[model samples]
Target chain A: MEQQNELSFDTLVIGGGIAGSEAAINLANLNYKVILVEKDLSLGGKMIHLSKVFPTLDCAACITTPKVSETIRHPNITIYTYSEVKNIVKVSEKKFTATLVKKPRYVNEDLCTGCQECEDKCPVVVKDQFQYDLVGRKAVYVPFSIANPRVVNIDIENCILCGLCEKVCPVDAIDFTQEDVEIPLTVKSVIIATGFELFDPTQILRYGFGKFKNVVTAMQMERQLVPTRPYNSVLRPKDGKMPDNIAYILCTGSRDETVGNPICSQICCMYSVKQAQLLLGALPMADVSIYCMDIRAFGKGFCEFYQQAVGMGVEFHKGRVAKITEKENGNLILRYEDIEEGKIKEVEHDLVVLSIGVLPNPDAKLLFDSPVIESDEFNYVKQTDELLCPPDTNIKGVFVAGTSSGPMDIPDSILSAGAASACSANYIRN
Target chain B: METKKIKTIDIIKEKRTVSAEAKQNLKEYNKIKKLILKSLESEAKTIPQIAAETELPLDVVTFYLMTLRRYGSIETGEIDDMDEYFSYKLKK
Candidate 1:
């Protein structure tokens, strides 16, 4: 990537996800030259996908939007989306040289206006990933509503060789032939905020998500509930109508080692509570029950939020669902031993939502050397300790915050964002 | 004078992590009590002396001095202004 001799910055942040974004902002605010790199085409990270953050039923987009806007406006900060940090060389104890690959977005970034006609007209149809496949979009699309560097993309695979997009482009921005460009940079310190991904539910066949249309992941719920599109309205996928009762199964992929994640995801319980609360807040008629082994409300005001959910009439029975089978006539039969009752019980629900867990992004290991940062048994980044050094990673000058380090709610994500910023600034200062 | 021993920190995290009992009123004021008790025969030392000896949260140390005065544990009388430094003294 260094073949270009690009301008160097004081701090370089990998992963334009929440932690990295926060770190970049922190350093920039402290008057340090900062560069934030994101593999995706835009910023806001995973914090954007959540419907509402816990402790405050505040809209997720509302929290992330201002941060993205601020990052764009920071004079000391440079943002590189659709980019990857290829390599890093420790240049003495004070400087680090990095090789970065800036992937071609195919659209002339400079000329293509954010007018979004390219997104509207692009004939190639692909699953709208932001909506978690409940929706579809033309391959050339914006990542989400609150995306930074608001730009459109052209999906190379599904383009249909349609010159329609190229013909309609006012700036001749469509460049299907553009190849990957390598750039090199030198920075004083590098921070890794590569965020985690949702543990794919398909791996847990016993959950029956693939076997049934009614069963869905928590992420899918957030996407559907987001205002970007029409919410499916909590209806059963098969019948398209509200049901008498809804079941939310917490930690479907968390705190269970057989599925390969034994650590508590840390945010599932609270977000599940928020989901239940949101249901009660919006519908006021839906009966909700959450099945889980234990609730971990470790964040500020989190335990209060959990209690608030309980006060709102959520039945939080402690149990791991043993068998969930789709019953005929559009219902699910849940058979599990409720730890509180100490007896096996059966319940039927119209829709079942699995509070799925977060996993390290698949490409996380590829971009860095082994053990540069300490990871938990589940491969999530480990916080150095509970206090004093909240977002610090093992490597010097590289700090982590948000779910990139561990599972957290929105306020904690913002807190970590501020903490990461402080860490980055400290590194730059010293 | 609320100088909680090191053992109290562990007791908070391990014993009552989910309970309000974790926050307790300690036995003595942090360092002023230490200073006043140590200075039973004389007046209290300067702010710099207390700060130098106690690595405490800044606001916490201030709060204790204010509380001591409220409870008649220390009497406040300003000393000669040595340019920018202020000193406090123990009550009889």
Candidate 2:
């Protein structure tokens, strides 16, 4: 057994996503020591995978990469990617002890260059999760081109024990002997910025997500619009055909009691609209339509963005998609109820994108040992003083941020993170 | 150096446990990979053309071709003007 490592910090941020990264940077800038732990292999979270952010249409990676770089270079911030917080014990009002488990990447961070030699030599091929499995990756791969730390991880489950990656490595960084290391840390305050999970569209059999090859999640369509797109263009996944008619179904699992997530996923409307606009530009002749119960353009300049999409020939149909059936040619027949006309309608599209909603990631609550952090009926972290301080968790010195509390867009998530960091700093001072 | 490499392989074999399902998957993937490479040996072809030649599903052929493309085993050529499928060829 390896010797356990112990560290102490002023604050511990549970996620390395946008909110968590912002909070960590804020505290670090304030001369307070902060540790950021992320479960994935990289610092940039789901935001990095997006093509362009809503409203501004700014490149998503352009926004995330600099923040990730800043977070990495900050003197007062420590990051633990490919790690999870197992348990957090509140020792005192001003102090908490957290136990983290760091999973091995099988490549030494110090020696391995971001070179693709090992990835090229490896014989095994598996689904690339970063590309949403639209493409395949090698057994040993860097998660994505812009992954923070830009290191490769060995998928031991898929690796064939072929030793090809080990042999081909210029730095000999592959270390199969590496094991999971337990890290114990003492922090003065804790911030729960762990993010939300995308509602799986596969759960809705009526949408025909997995059953219909042309039907994809909104994230999958977003991936095709990026520079690192898998297909090089937004094409039908079934046959690689250029889609002539594309349909976006908003609120796939949101604002529906049957799906058990009744609250609106605030960002879906704008993101789907953004994708529709991008698709229209990419395939100029293709017709793009968005079917939604209603367009909830709530944020600043959001209504203008919606109107811009409408002006750009994005057909906005006020309707709720009931079910989808696939033709032999992989075209999807959407059966929907027209809310404006109060009539049932059916339409065919070459490709369909399901605008899935956000659901609360309840994994963060399990880390607490005493006075378990309370979550709402929907499993979002219960904001005890949402009106006064939206970040205040029930437990003193513990705060919540981002979609860990509820579904929010990027701007609101950042605001929530700022509030959480402010509340944490105030608690530590007092 | 060869002896040291063999020893490391032995260590991996001892330490790692490969499941039956995983082994079966590897075997299947290798077989499919060989078939796809063989079909692309003579000339560049689109995914549908490869699928037709190999008598495999379009998704399966696309998955392997994309993987090969990413890893530099294959390269994509111009799109077919008729059907819009990109022509793939074994990398020289």
Candidate 3:
């Protein structure tokens, strides 16, 4: 209890995604005592799933790994991976006490050296959740190559009741008996950097995502296209065939009231183009079509990059997709009214990639002392307009950043992360 | 010993906070009289420059500038770096 009560920091960050990861690192660099609490076992968030970043096409892992590494190594940062915030209380004015639920990894993280030998010996195999169920890994396995803390975890339910790991433990690190622990942390402020969740195409029903193997979400495609990704290459999961034509449906759940998110996701169009580039690069002969309403490249060099994507033989359809059907030969058939031709047309392709929209993460609504400010139905935080009397929220020191504000790309997320850092600093910066 | 060269941490020793001062104003116009006079002595700073000085996100800087202008505390003078930014100098 003393250990729990003794732990306190200047800031508590919920969600270890790009926004929280970056926000925690930024705050720690500013010399603020920080506790970065992530519900998942790893950081990096959706940014990790991305194969290549937009505008620059830099390797997503290459850029995100350093930030992950920095967050883990920063002296001021206390990272609680595989932990969830259970309660938040304002004990004093402008201060927050947060109770966190830390799920058991079932292995002694302090003693385990991340040696995968135990995983190799384990007889159980489970679907790698991080891979979108595209691949299988041992029940006791590291989530990814770059998971922060770089430690392995055991899937207790899937374990084959084998005691071989315990017999061969050099450090006695394997602990199947460890129970779930609750950690309480107090801080001056809290930042809800909980990133967005993917919109399920099953909501639209016309896409038939769960039934169609050829049809995939843009996130699934990213996992496939990323070289370091579990599968290592792109192929149809249905028949294991490398198809040459892929059609991308942009704004699948974005800008549609029936699907619930009507606001522009703001980043779908660019990521769609980037995925098109990756597809073209992977399979040079692949013919690609992007059914998009508009291409917004508002940032610096974004428009030019979009133009270059156009030059690279990716067709830009200025219309919405009406429907997609699975063909006999495991091909995806896209049927939509070409706004340009004013006629309904159908095209057959090996894969149909849904550029899904981003919405507020479900876990963002955890803080009890300070409430998350809502600007849109999508839950992007609203900002006060007047300069001198700008409207910050009920939370004294906490601020919003990245896609938590709306659907923004890496550059925009980075910009918001910086802004939140600045405004949060005004309260305690001196 | 080095003289405190032009105290960069320059702050007013006014007895009232900004909110308190606003409450004590004789009239809406008369109330902002000091703020107007104070803004006259400020100068505008660009977005990047402000980010460099304040170490904040560009969006926050632009956002805060907008708020300051609306409150008659700051004003925008020019566009640089392909985005419009404001100077920190007080608005008259």
Candidate 4:
């Protein structure tokens, strides 16, 4: 038999998002050897890319970076970035075994210094996905400035292999022969904190998201408002013009049967309102409008935040946007039904933002073989008792946290992670 | 220099060709890039002026200029008289 190169840990946290980081830190502080596995090159998930979070107007990176740094530097926590858990099998009542595959970054982690020499020399420029394709990144790139590891990974598929990057590296860190490394992990407990993916707006043809240049998603606009924004200022993508009027379409893909997602995304409305306020600050003389079926400000101080936007001269149209059409000058014409006035109205705006919904990422379900991990009707990880024990999955000693269980805001995600960590710790002690 | 460095260079040279689609795309990009560089050879120009000179779409011109700026081939200068768009110049 081949030797199983097995490493053991007290607990395994399957993601490095806000919830996963919180859970890992809590577990590590308890003096438990915890392993945090993240598929991305960075520790902070989508939160780091955001400009500012809702209700607090706090810089999203400001809140996330400290936690990320803490998680990475924690003595009891070991991090695996650019890695995935292939299969996780329940070994016993209290033990689980997992197969982790670490993808090659083609750069030696120990030797590399985070310098831009290789990035500057590379001639191939591709869409920067971290910036939501609003800008170009070289084939060899660190995902963003605040990426935790702050090391560049070569996009092997897109790399022309002209040896420019290899030649420019001060330290001989570029290794083309690097291959994926498989790691077997034995753990006493497992926490699934794999987060959610945003709903793609292209499926809703009526919104004209892909066809219309000025029609951007909420996340894209969030990037534009950030300090490391793709552009120097917020200009409409179609003609590079400073927009005067901007409209927001709330609930783009959520609560709509057509897209097959019927539940409320629980964050789109508040985020849209937040973006509207930020846009007004960015463009002082610009007009902002929001069209929504209903203002579902269900969280603490959320209603006050919505009202504050209204107080700041933001036009809140109680309506449902039916369709959007592009004008000759890259402006947008929105056809919506005004619910309060009971009239169908057509309005023009230079820029429109589609507040896309959150969808459950079902990737964690594929990592288990026996005692098949259960998913609810909406495809989120099933919680046996949401009120009593919110983080317990169907399998014993295994837990689910954050958006892996369902759609939740950042505060809820953190609370969920705490619960999962506590429950796992208790389970381990018993 | 070293044998290991020479081997890496040889591997890169052997495997450096782009795909058909990428090659065609690069060819088109180089064509537009050359035109923009030629137009900016005499003086720095705003995005709209470059668009007009190159007869390219404003979005296309802006994307290319931004890409060039990112790769250190171009740099931004003073804003236009209207204070709307910044002028771009070739990096010396």
Candidate 5:
């Protein structure tokens, strides 16, 4: 691979999600030269895709957009989207050498104006994963309308290579010949803020997430409620009808040893309630119900939020979903053992959202030498002292932040990032 | 010595060769998409109406309709009051 220009920073913050972005901004404010690397084409991370934050029901985009813009505008912070840390080597006690790979956006970043001319001419269409595949995106297009940097990336896997995009490029920024380049950096400290991935509900065969039309994941439902939603309104994926009956199956992939994740995904309960509240507002007449083994309203003001949801007439049923079968009319029949009734009861709904769990980024260890770092039983970065030094990993000068440590909501993730920044800054200063 | 830049696209393509099962699935998807287009040929139809006419699952029909809309082959017309699904017609 061709080597890009060598770069060095005081600190390297991996994963440009909210946690990483916040950490970078914090470090930058401290006058530390920082580098923020994101594997995705954009920097907002999973938080940007969410419709609203729980407890407050604040617009998620409104909260995430400013962080993204701040990270981009920070003079001391060098943001590299569509990039990853390939390898990290300890050079000295508090110094490390890292190799960063820049994945090709297939467009010249410096010259390319964020124009959709090339996208307008591209012919191939495929499922937009950014929108949870609810809508289709061009093979050559920007990630989203509000994407940070607003640069177009060619989905080379789906691109037909008709060269129409190149022909229409006014600035000739479309580069089919672009390649991944490796750039080396030396930093005094490193923060592994690589976030978590949503648990795939298809693994729980009983839920019928991939098979049934009306069955969707909570993340997919969140996408439907966003301002940039694929459909004009929150309509059922099956038949595009405004669903009168909606159901949320909490702990779909969490708290189940069968799926290998037994811990309660802390955000699932609150997020399900938040989505239920939003759904009630969007579909005032729709009957929204949540089936869960327990509602963990443990967070601050979370109980009040739960009460608010109940006040809005959202049903909270304590039960364990046994199975979900699709009816002929595309409605879903959910069979669960109602704790109150002590019997298996069936409820029919037009749409069912699976509140999937969160899992550590499986590739966390791959970014560094495994022998240098240790992962807990759940594969999250092992913190040395959860009570005192929550961000300190097994390796000195390297800290773990956000969901990289464990499942956490936005506020906790941000607080974890703050702890990581402090640890990294202290290490660098020493 | 000149170093060759590694194209990530080639790496992606090398790893993503279509499987026979995937090809079969694609064929099935194209068939369903064709059926949806044919249904829209006569008149604008809501998603549920199309699902009933085509005998395809509602979610499956909705997926095809969205794909068609993205391709600029379908456009939304009037909305049905009963179910609130828009009547989708073939874009002229």
Candidate 6:
């Protein structure tokens, strides 16, 4: 362990996602010193991975990139990427000291010029988790092209000692001698915007998500549609063939008692419809269908989008997919119960996407031990009043925002983050 | 506090030794890589064609093809109009 470094800030934000970034920027604009900690090498979270936002179908990166840049360049904000909040101890009503562990990136942040020389020369190739493991990335590479603090991180686990990256570096930025350091931060208030994780559909044995290559998650489909997509176009992973008939199975891991998550993951219905619309435009001759228990197009302009998808000839079936099996030619067979027709029917599609639900990030609980930040039955941070004080956690100076509180869309998440920032700012002022 | 400096190459060498499980995995990976290279030797072939000829799973073939493509061992030739799959040829 290296010598612990002590720093003080007006606020400490636990995540570097859209919500946390928004909160940090808002507080920084208010002339408050804020420290933002992220568990990944990059600042942008799930939003960066998305193709586009709902209803308006605006580019997701377009909305996130500016915020990430602003947060990174903000003078009042200090970002600690690839760091974790190990413990938080409350000393006073409005003061808390947090122990953070900053993992080594193996490259000196000040020396790296964000060039791709090291990445180009590195011979070790591993699955790129940013692309949902659909493609390969060099062992020494940045998280993405537009990543804030565009510095290369050496994947120490997979890196071979070939030293090609070091030899080819123009500025000699590659360094493997770095070790993890402990950072102690004292802050007046805390904001929890740690985002949600997608439910792993592989637990549902019948869905065959991992077993069948053609059956992918909704996020994987989003990756296929993004501008920085893994492939040239959307193709089935099993054979890299353009799929003519694609099926979307809604509520794969949500609203199911068996999976222990019974809440309706509020964004799945709209996103599935959005993806169906995008797929129709991308592959005009192909047939796109969505199987769901119900169409909950409850957001503003969302019902209109659903209607627009219907008008575009996208098929919407009111059914629950029972099982999915792969065919001999890498196609998928979907067995679903047709509630409208009152019969169980089988449909075949070249590709299938499982609209998995959201769950609270399991790390939120592990970050704090002092005030015992209470969480609801669903593991979302418990709010004093779900209607009134939505961002107020049991801890006095601590606030929860975004999907960390519950399931919400991008817009709602931004609003919740705004609320959290207001709450933290108010606490810091008084 | 007195601190000693260490070479990056020394640290990298210390961490690069493969475990038994990793050794087995590397062996399997090389075997699949060789099969893929052999399949693309005669002519350019699509992922499905290579998978069928080599009697390997399509996902396994796809993973190795991606690895080989990253290593500059394979290059995409053309998209087959019939199935819309890209043909990959071994790099000369």
DockQ of each: 0.00, 0.54, 0.01, 0.44, 0.28, 0.41
Kindly report which residue pairs in candidate 6 clash with one another. Answer: none
| Candidate that would win on lDDT | 2
| Model 1 alpha-carbon drift over 4 Å, by segment | A1-3, A230-232, A369-376, A382-392, B1-92
**TM-score of predicted chain B, candidate 6:** 0.79
Best by DockQ: 2
Tens-place lDDT per residue, model 4, B1-92, is 65633636466456556677665656677787898889899999887788898899877887777777766678878866555567889999
Q: TM-score of chain A for candidate 1?
A: 0.92
List where candidate 2 sits over 4 angstroms from the true fold: B1-9
**Quick one: best TM-score, which candidate?**
2
Q: Is candidate 2 or candidate 6 better by lDDT?
A: 2
Least accurate stretch of 10 residues (summed lDDT) in model 5 chain A?
A156-165
Interface RMSD of 3: 29.2
lDDT of 1 by residue, A48-100 (tens): 77777778778877877787888878999988899888667666655777778
Give the least accurate 10-residue stretch of model 1 chain A, judged by summed lDDT.
A230-239
Model 5 ranges off by over 4 Å: B1-42, B51-57, B70-73, B90-92
A142-191 per-residue lDDT for model 5 (tens digits): 88878998989987766655567777888878776677899998889899
Q: Which candidate would rank higher by DockQ, 4 or 5?
A: 4
Better of 1 and 2 by DockQ: 2
Q: Write the per-residue lDDT of candidate 4 for residues A170-210, one digit (tens) a residue.
A: 99888876778888999999999999999999999998987
| TM-score of chain A, all candidates | 0.92, 0.99, 0.93, 0.98, 0.99, 0.99
Give each model a TM-score: 0.77, 0.97, 0.78, 0.95, 0.92, 0.95
Worst 10 residues of 2 chain B by lDDT: B1-10
Candidate 1 clash pair list: A1-A183, A2-A184, A26-A421, A140-A153, B1-B28, B1-B29, B2-B28, B2-B29, B2-B30
lDDT winner between candidates 2 and 4: 2
Docking class of 6: acceptable
